[model samples]
Target: MVTGPAPTAARRSVEEVRERVAAVPDPELPVIGLGDLGVVRSVATGADGVIEVEITPTYLGCPGMAAITSAVRDVLTACGHPDGRVRQVLSPPWTTDRITPEGRRTLLAHGIAPPVSPAPDGPVAVEVGGVPCPHCGSRATRPHSPFGPSRCQSMLWCTACREPFPHLTAL
Candidate 1:
């Protein structure tokens, strides 16, 4: 009887690598996957079986980049791609617009307000106005601080709920 070769770890495809990497969570935002956050740009596997992943950070000098990179490597290695490497792409830069709808929902559910989308006509005009409060869904929120615990987040206080929440800054 003739039988085909058995599937092996070495036979892992680029798609498989991508799927595995996609499941990797963001270091700072554990609730959202890197894929949902639009951080993972592309995944490619070389003939030598080395997998390379391209990623774009939410902003330059984002402290979580190093952690995110390490997590990607760990995930890839565990998925049988021990030679996987993550490459950061900063040419085009990252925008809040890149965030997936599911990611936005996740952020909101996590009590962090997602960045407002840029106006269709042009870029959103930055105004000193109220940002919707994630806790009470009130537009009576004010910026408590221009900065939050993380670089990409802004601290906001909701007048309705009298609570402070993080708002994802628009890039």
Candidate 2:
């Protein structure tokens, strides 16, 4: 809770509000914005003049949701939309495929191999040999562990570079 003088309300369009909210960074993965991460489902203004931001969680029990929600609320309040509220929309659950191309590039640049997008009707196919290594861009990476710091990621070790990195798993 930010405790300061209340910001003056400004008349911003829905798109403006959406852009401001979408620009918020993912708390866990600061390299990607919520929009690029595909968590920001929608932003709109209600008839009551309250701003509504809808987001989908990457996983059902993602630990970062609280932080994300807090960040959204803070941003809204700072921008003068004190009535703004965040809504968690779980329908049509989030999948790795929702990650934007820019998000993938950002992850790779940050030494995390982005998950291969899954098929429209199915989950991602398991890599037969190994997944690509973000460090060396080699396909000689093996899974160090199926579990990672987060539910949507796995630890991988690159044989080519002998480096360990996280891979965003396809949901």
Candidate 3:
């Protein structure tokens, strides 16, 4: 891996740390980077040169949060920022709306149905609606189960394609 310059007497810049942390992929969704998923909330470097990365989990009990934290630390350390800290902030809960447009396209390309954008007013239930199938791009898709392999996803079956896929739950 290409490493950045070691931190000098002064702390490294936030943008420098963010650039490296942004490249770290989500443990559950490898196709999407933490930045693209809008999970890496902020990156800051202290006067002592320690970097802190704040992230928000997609769900309250998301199992991947631990892995994502470790991955962020590992990436920062590899990039010459050792002893990096990963903080999980729960104040502003994460929402599917945070996922970027490019991330949504990447999810669809990876055969995972991206979550539909929630109403701007507030959160909405992800009921059986007009969620298009990722594989066939058909609107004839139905929810097979409320739960999926992961807490943030739901099992969906495409009627036209006769295939089952995981749909990211909109929160």
Best by lDDT: 2
What TM-score goes with each of the models? Answer: 0.84, 0.87, 0.81
Model 2 bad stretches (over 4 Å): 1-9, 119-128
Q: For each candidate, C-alpha RMSD in Å?
A: 4.9, 4.1, 5.2
| CA error at residue 67 for candidate 2, angstroms | 0.8
Model 1 has how many clashing residue pairs? 0
- Which candidate has the highest TM-score of all? 2
Better of 2 and 3 by lDDT: 2
Q: Please provide, for model 3 over 1-171, each residue's C-alpha lDDT reduced to its tens digit, 9 standing for 90 to 100.
A: 989975544345668779778878888888899998989888887677677889998888888888888888777776566677889999799988889899999999999999778667887766665689999889888889998877778899999989999999888
Give residue 17's error in model 3 in angstroms.
2.5
Looking at model 1, residue 135 earns an lDDT score of 80
Which lDDT tens digits does candidate 1 get at residues 11-39?
Answer: 46778879878888888888889898889
Look at candidate 2 and tell me the lDDT of residue 115.
83
Q: Residue 25: error of model 3 in Å?
A: 1.7
Task: Give candidate 3's whole-model lDDT.
Answer: 0.84
Query: Which ranges in model 1 have alpha carbons more than 4 Å from their true place?
Result: 1-11, 47-49, 120-129
